[model samples]
Target chain A: MPVTAVLHTETRVVRRLTTDFPALIAPDETAVDVTGLDINLSGGFTVLELDNSLRPASPEEALESGVDEAAAGARRKTRHRAASVALGAAAADPLSHTSLREALTKLRLAMYGE
Target chain B: MGLSVKTGSFVTETATGSKAYTGLGFQPKVLLLWSVGGVTAGTFRTGAYTSVGFGTDSTHRAALGWSSQNGQNFSNCARTQGPNVLDLVQWDVTTHIRADLVSMDSDGFTLNYTTVNATAKIVHYLAIGGSDITSCTVLDWPCGVATGNKVVTGVGFQPDAVMHLSIGEPSSGSSLQADARLSFGMMEAGGGQWSNVIYSVDNSGTSDSQRHQQTGKCIQKLTTTPSVNMAAQFVSMDSDGFTVNFTSVTGVAERVFSLCLKGGSHSLGSFSAITSGGPAQDSPSLGLAPLTYLLSSFNSSGQASPIGSTRWSLGGSDGTSEETAWANDTDALGTSASDTLSKTDKAIVICSATPAVLGEADHSALGSDVFTLTWSTVPVTAHELLYWAIGAGAAPAARIPRWLPVMRTHDPRPLDAVA
Candidate 1:
């Protein structure tokens, strides 16, 4: 039982899309949560670190990390949606664990941890 | 996918758009590099690695650089000026770095840049690391002739946060015209600590406000100067990494960006000084546990009452901008608010708790100045914001440090650092 991961933070006012003229704005959002991590944190977190994991892939993982090209699939114009909408309704609110996956699982447990 | 992030892309030729572009596996504490230019300049580098590979018994690094090149905009070290010089906000060039993360393979580390290029620049770097990052010092330098106040010292340890950036100034025009600036700063290392200077441009480029205005130039100060002396080229901070005092150093040569963050590095949890009579107020409750946040309405929103992210605007109030970024949020704003509010604009949100978070699980019911517009009708401004919280508790530290020459090499492949 040497597994520890308890980090939680959730502040919301959500909605943002500024340019003015009713472009939409709520601003004042914050998120992070991990209660015990086995899986399912809730939705609302996005905390990356750990060399961002070597960054460079998100056009569907850059075409499965092969990166065919088209400006590298344009670096993600589509894909990245099952849900996870930048916190709007807190991503969908599964109890809100801070979404973006789980901030990608916290960047892969910060580069492969537990 | 827990935290150690990584993303790469580079294309700036004309003979090495400066230099030092590593694999970014460890030698990074927190480096973000983006590009989209107009009235541009050159010079770049941002690092954090305490013992990665470089003379002095082989490893120690912390970096930041900026070069506008033209009679050299006078002050630098990724910028640190307390006097004047800033007001160009054109478009794209958002860079933010936080350092400390050593052990690079077998003595490997370098993120170089010395100036050269006003064209072919296509960069998109993002390297994040873990293990609560212990150390990294990137104090790069380049000031050809005239000198006076510019200091960067032995950052052996002792650093919670400090950032500054400057390249070579002179180029506040070209394009749809907004406010072209390439100077940046943000801080947190101790008391009197408050530093911000940004102008991320996105003036009605309208791709969702260019995805978040990305412009406005920044300014923030509450300096005590730990060892700083940078006439503010762009950004500034403390905890050993420049004790600058170059009242005037010409011949165009100023490029500095110093980053140092020990453990977590991101202090000051909550602060909401937004009193004016808005029909929407609530910000008097952040004691911690509420992650993510960084704002600047400094001396109230500009443009005759323009602070309406959620409220504090009655000049022509337009609520509900409908959005909530954090699919991995990273922001750099300051396009207009009368130009980043003069001094007082900074946001470094990454949370879990701290800032004096009380109990009941440390409450984060999220109630900051919850306004909608109505502060005595309109005009008592300074649309405030200053929240700095990071991570939450401390987790990431499983891999990265893979370069065994053997010296305490535990080998199960989890934690075995040595540069």
Candidate 2:
């Protein structure tokens, strides 16, 4: 499953410095889950157009890519830790619900491939 | 190690002092700032001042600034005055104030300026960060009174893009009354496509401003007669920078400041507005997804649609902030506003007296290597649009297998069996 985090946007921008992973802000308040990507929120936002290949994959993807189950689990743990911190940071802001909605929607798609 | 960018604004100190803009998260390799001085009350007029600087450290850097004085007078600091990035003065050159980027720090940069003139200058800046940038160069060239190509070289590498400013020496000495031009030119590496907007102010009697915009031209001098009516075009992207061909010229050598870039994916070209069929238009394929883009419009023959009007826009996503600056002779005014609905394709350019949308388009979708420009209202006649796009780098051509087939940890067969 994909990890989740809320992101705050100022003028629709989320600073990359606010998160550990590469973050993509949603176009609007409507949260979007671009699975394999990271999230966060802050100011001085510059939209970054990233190469899709570099995105981080879920544990299932790691295993599918031929990694051992233990290795995939380790990757999951790392992602979880990073997401937890990002989530806490974004949730602290009252204006992060839309970002959260986008993030949750992305997470749901990643989890169920919906 | 690829190029990354950040945009923000700051107000210059009322008193002469040093200040730092921190929290950028990455050290910037180059900085470009345009004065938003006219937006607030007691502020300077917009486009009156602009600056560009480069270097990772203060000790080994170069900077330049160009400003237009109200009486059709102007001045520029080109790597002189000890590394200062800005030199600003009031309508007349009285208490000349200066500022410098003294340090380029890990997280941000520092600026040291002079004097509290009561009114502070609000500056908008774009900072480019990354180690992969091959070079960031500043060039000050002269556009003399003669019609010919003025090829600018010495960048040391084929630059991907360039920004130009036109500052001519005052026809009369210290009095500083004459014609000055504030120009912005965008040129791409591929095909040498170019587009530019030149705003010239002639303070002969009253403050008279002329807007000269063109799609296929670069550095141009369009002041009233006897002042060198010059028009230039992009020649080629040379190995050691690029070249410009000034087809028409006359007058003393006018100074031009250029900030050139090397190492980054850049796409620049022009397209015409649709007046037939449908209102949908697509820019020439950039071959990559762009992070930011600038679009400006001109007439079919490379002049403003209404002849004496001006319009240009800069846009990017993040909640999508689009900034537009427009002016016309009737109003004799220039103003900018932030539009949140701006996207890669959904941006418009207008040059009406009321600044109504002569041509309106919204970014419909960003494709793999192209974006769709869906016009809300097509122009009554065809207009030309010049656009420049910057990308972090090219996208991967295809998804490679995430991993080569690896042997199972508990594989019964020998590891070398498959090999």
Q: Write the per-residue lDDT of candidate 2 for residues B124-180, one digit (tens) a residue.
A: 556777755667776656653333345667777777777665544322111222223
Tell me the tens digit of each residue's lDDT in model 1 across B314-366.
00000211101100101222211110000001111111101110100011122
Docking class of 2: incorrect
**Candidate 2's interface RMSD, please?**
29.3
The stretch of ten residues in a row with the least summed lDDT in candidate 2 chain A is A12-21
Window of ten residues with lowest summed lDDT in model 2 chain B:
B72-81
Best by DockQ: 1
Candidate 1: lDDT of B310? 12
Candidate number of the best TM-score: 2
Error of 1 at A49 (Å): 21
Q: What is chain B's TM-score across the candidates, in the order shown?
A: 0.24, 0.68
Computed on alpha carbons, the lDDT of every model, listed in order, comes to 0.27, 0.47
